[model samples]
Target: VVKWNIDKAVKGDPDYIVDRINVHYNIGHLQAVGGDSTRPAGDYLLALNKLSKDQYLPVGPDLPENQEIIDISGEQMKMLASFPTPPEPHDAT
Candidate 1:
């Protein structure tokens, strides 16, 4: 027997929801209901960003402190200081 609850549960996730909405809207369904235009654009975008959490956050300014780290160590530091050539890449033949 087909299990409707299981099927519905899988289809109801956030990724599934976003994908379905995008597919419908993008494929000539300009007047699709309950999508971006129906909701306040700014509010909907903000909610989507919050809902997506790890995926949609802006890259640079507001990223968590630990995420954007420019580690200057070893050869990187030497090169920046104009010290000398670092090391040539290994030729794997």
Candidate 2:
């Protein structure tokens, strides 16, 4: 459900998704202190990739065979749509 949508959003725009998730998830100052700050993004992608394949199952019983079928609720879809789109690049020609 939520996980699938998040996966889609992450795949759609890794940079934007990572930035927002990092800020929202708040890995904090210790994790952010480094020249290679995109580690958080990398870690997130790694985790998502693992989950997507069912390689890393949850702690309890296995989920359904079909996986979770997710329909974007009207409110959730609207919220996602409301997020401001990335700014367009200026024509330099």
- The best candidate by lDDT is 2
Query: For each candidate, what is the lDDT?
Result: 0.21, 0.23
Q: Work out the TM-score per prediction.
A: 0.13, 0.14
Question: Model 2: clashing residue pairs?
Answer: none
Write candidate 1's Cα lDDT for 1-92 as tens digits: 01123455677753322111111011111211233445532211101111122333455555311111111222121111101111221111
Candidate 2 lDDT tens digits, 1-93? 122347657578643332222112211112111225543331111111112223233544542111111123333311121111112211111
Off by over 4 Å in 1: 1-49, 63-93
Quote the lDDT for 44 in model 1: 17
Q: Show pairs that collide, candidate 1.
A: none
